[model samples]
Target: MIIQAYNFLASWQLFPEKGEYQSGNRPKSGYYRINASDDKSRLNIEHTWVTLENDAFNATFSIIPDGELHDFENAVLADQFKASIADTSNLEISFYKNDRETLHVLHQITPNGLLKITQTGTAPAGEQFTNIEIYHKQMSVLPYAAAVSGAVIRPTEEGMIRHKALTAMEEQTNMQMDQIRRQIELLALQAREIVSRKELSMLIYNARLNFSPVIGQVYYLYEKKTGDHQVSMISPREWGNGSGPFKTFVAKVKLLADHTWVEVE
Candidate 1:
């Protein structure tokens, strides 16, 4: 189509396709993920990052010869590849391969409007960017779109992983906080129980005890008309309507060997 200008990133897998071997420690192609020790993991990452970058340099078909063609870089590279040319063209059998560092080759416009590859540089780093003219040419944006799939898709997938990790970390922190809260609540309850037990023991001990209270024995406590407190073996239920000087039923309790009193139901 008639091209004005365009630009795009690329995408490529660091892992290999099915049946692809990782024979030489260098992953065949694409991303590499392995569950191993730290040293081995680091090595794999180093290998993948380096080789992936190598592929990216080759797959990065948008490296126009010079900055002047920068605006139309997408247009220029798009015309050279087919819709199915997803990675560095060399990897596919339908095209040629160059193991050296080269993102894109030079091209010239023929009389018929086809852009021809005239300088697929020979050096390991490929040729220098020679100033060129790329004013009017028919190019397809669809092909360029496919060429940049590697640079475009990989980051998004990686971002998804980071996002999930963040979410998991946040959930873990929340659980920790919840556990701490539960512990605090339990401790507060225990503290209140201890205070209640001490107050009960003091009240029962100070009250008028007509006879010695035995350990592990049940008893009753009451407030007398003279405002004096009393401890007795008689239960509140047994204190018929108006038997003793009981002005108020205090609480039912039991005596422990430690001389402490515990409220009974």
Candidate 2:
């Protein structure tokens, strides 16, 4: 069976290191590793974000595994059961999977001793894993006073910042001008009348020749004479004015590599 999507729910405990104490003098730093599994096999799972709490870190992974059906289980388990490390302040946790580092989270304890976390990494795409590892390093905490001092304006730095800002503004203006130019060109094409059958066909093929057509775009059009259908390039002239907007009275066709349209179901 072809699987379009997969959904899973898993919960596991984060055990402390062997002989590590968890009392008033709790361990300042530690890590946890969890795996995604099925009944008899492990799934290849990839994720971003490694959260850390006072006692445990809970995670939920809903992912689309890539690879052959037979290896899905092992892939998920192997990929998920990687290494994690905590820094001295107990504020950050980094996860490593598949021999590569992935997911970094910085957390802080609230006044009530609750964990508050912020994560930076490649987010899940369509709930799928694009890469086996996704994470970010080079994170730090700067005091508010240090930040304020760094933001203080120096004459030389002010000039550089102004120059960069002006450059960005100019680039944005140029992009807007280019968009306006394309719009004008499209409007000109739409104003022109179709002169001949060959010209109309060419217009349909080269969507740029007429604003009403889009080249390399798929469209379903019906042929009246043969009751055949075609997946045509989006050309308003060819398929726009058919027998009503939606009607089923033709065989379906697909464009082939040799520029031929073949009938399909």
Candidate 3:
């Protein structure tokens, strides 16, 4: 996915000859502001404000950056300072990870297409920030469409098998997560108001550990204060092992729909 963010302030510039303030470049008397937008979220106009005097603005916005974005800014381009790229007039942002496009942002060819924000700058300490600023005079609107032609399609035996396994894994994981959540809720209810922090922590931890026990895994737990010294927790795959201590313990959960056990293994 190719993902990018572009922010611009709509402002009218005054020349030295037509100057209104002593600075000549930016007169305090003129009225100027910008309206910016993007995917992921919308900015409330009432919440958006720009400090004309500081040539800075604050607004609400969001972007879904590609996995490559982390690599681009952090790894390959680490040494480049934000000031060096602060003057970009326009930005063409594309995000891809492992050869798949995840997001794409194309700036319109309007006055707003002049500069892009790819650097970090200090702002007033208390402002909640979410977007970057860009400077441009013209922006061109690009046709927005999602492309999936490059995605790999599985057709071979191994590929089909792998796809089936992944589908099964996803379903199993979802089921396991739900079952674990319910178990945790029940255990929390039972352990509520426990005076000891250590006891509560152990209860929660054991509940989580048993929430989704693997098929072949054997879990061991013990406490010096408890009368029962040790416990051997086993899954269905370990059924062949001879029975040992039948301690007060929770069992691991099995999430696969194909399982026939009355309770999760």
Per-model TM-score on C-alpha atoms: 0.40, 0.18, 0.20
1 or 2, greater by lDDT: 1
In model 3, how large is the Cα lDDT of residue 171? Answer: 62
| Candidate 1 residue-pair clash tally | 14
Give me the runs in candidate 3 sitting further than 4 Å from their true place.
1-147, 151-158, 193-265
lDDT of 2 by residue, 2-66 (tens): 12112111211112222222111222222222234553233322221111322221123322233
Which scores greater on lDDT, model 1 or model 3? 1
The per-model lDDT (C-alpha) reads 0.41, 0.31, 0.31
Residues forming the 10-long window of minimal summed lDDT in candidate 2 = 142-151
TM-score, cand. 2 vs. native: 0.18
lDDT leader: 1
lDDT of 2: 0.31
> Looking at model 3, which ten-residue stretch has the lowest summed lDDT?
142-151
The local lDDT score (0 to 100) that residue 171 gets in candidate 2 is: 62
